[model samples]
Target: MAARWLKVLAAAPLMLSALTAAQPAQALVPYVAVPAERNLEGAGLGIAQAAARLLRIGQADDAARLAALTVQLIPDDPRGWVLLAEAQLRSNQNEEAAVSLAKARELDPKNAGILFAQGSLALKDSRPSEAADLIREGLKLDGNNAGAYFDLGNAYILMGKSGDALGAFERASKLRSDFWEAINNQALVLYEQNKAGEAIKRWRRVVGIKDAAEPNLALAAALNVAQPGNTESLQRAAKALAEDPNYVLESWQKEQLWGPRLRSAAAQLLAQPALKADVERAQANAGASDDLGDG
Candidate 1:
């Protein structure tokens, strides 16, 4: 009995080890860490700045694509929508620009700049009446906007309200003394109204202010009409044509919103035998037909 008990004690340690080895191990729970929060608005602003830079560099299509992404990232920001609208406008996607502007308006209804932008788009879409109304409303909110006044003048001109258009142009020039475009339009309206002397005076002032093609050509045409076969006028016309050959094309003139009176005057001036060579060269440069028709 004593010998059997000793053998069992010796085997006990091996049995205990086998039992420990046979037991199943417990599974460990995973430790999950949460991600850091993102500053989405700041990211959107950075993207918008990049888009604006692209636009400035004349990469309008790329600017528009990036602006679209920016709006998606910050849908609540009206500025983002406005930037997107500007990019879309530059890309010639007028309908998409309108939608983006509408969203901006919904977000910030009282913004005068947004209203002015909408008015400008209305003018581009050929809705002059709506454009005038929108611009007028914008002026009420921000009365000192010279560019808005200039646009309002254009709207009035399209609606055949010459007197109102003149007033608007004058207001624009008064608000911003160096606004040559508004002054030029004033001359345009004056010429249309048969005030050749006044138109010539305004055109002369515009040329003095800025040596641009539109005012230069306009003054040349007026001078030719007021004093036929004037050598100075012919010389000025030649120089203006060289500066911007597009003035030689009637379609281009109309696109610049040249009134019928101004266009007729330009046609007569261009028909001068002394201007034949200059007109031909200008036409060639503009890639237009040799015959300058009064369209």
Candidate 2:
């Protein structure tokens, strides 16, 4: 169910603010559309390559299947094993992912990507110390990997090192400006550090940059807290609910991502009468594509 939600989130269109030319303060909305091409079928190329392409296009289930097949097809290739682990991880097949990662480790003990993956799995398992050490070693091998830096940020956050996490997130954003996930986490770290003003600024930048549920909601909630009962802020919150209603409808608490502080903000914003009514309306009218209920 979580995997399905990820696919929906990945494919959804940018739902930016409906702005007029006169609103000079409003930032221009960035639009992004993922290409819809499901043509790869493990043809001519190796199964790992095929799986990688599928995974890039938000087809994790299909990618996992292909990756599983790849291990059987090319048992000696550590790349196949690593690909399988990645696909399984995406599909939320944690145990299978572990098995695949272990096999890849046996084949190539120093593989940076595998080490990074293992680090992520360790983080997921709540072993932040181990995760941090593994990722640091992985970074020594591949210092240029933005994704690894992002994962390292997650480890730092779990370890309650907000300052370190912020640095990691900043490095990730420097490496890839379009890495909104890292930017979002930076906002989270800021919030965790009690830097509400700075966090709100980062959240607003993310809302202006893209129209994802998490960022939009963060901006809405922070704006509400900054200026309670403000009509414009309420409207923005309404707009976010209109963009993706199910987060409120299902009362989906993504504490793993948002943490207690942000979740409390979201709850506070949701409790607002005007925004609550607006969200309930959006929930009634929204289709499946606009929903992310509970998962």
Kindly list the per-residue Cα lDDT of model 2 for residues 1-295, writing each as its tens digit. 4475445334322211132134444344356222222212232135567678889988888888867766754566788888888889888899999999989999998889889999989998889889999999999999989998999998898788888999999999899988888898999888867788899888777877787877877777777777777776677777778776655643454534566777777778878887767867866775676344314
* Over 4 Å off, model 2: 1-66, 249-256, 281-295
In model 2, which range of ten residues has the least summed lDDT? 11-20
Query: What C-alpha lDDT values do all the predictions have?
Result: 0.86, 0.76
lDDT of 1 at 213: 87
Q: Scored by Cα lDDT, where does model 2 land?
A: 0.76
Q: What TM-score, over all chains together, does every model reach?
A: 0.84, 0.72
* Candidate 2 displacement at residue 94 in angstroms: 1.6
lDDT, candidate 2, residue 226? Answer: 76
Clashes of each: 0, 0
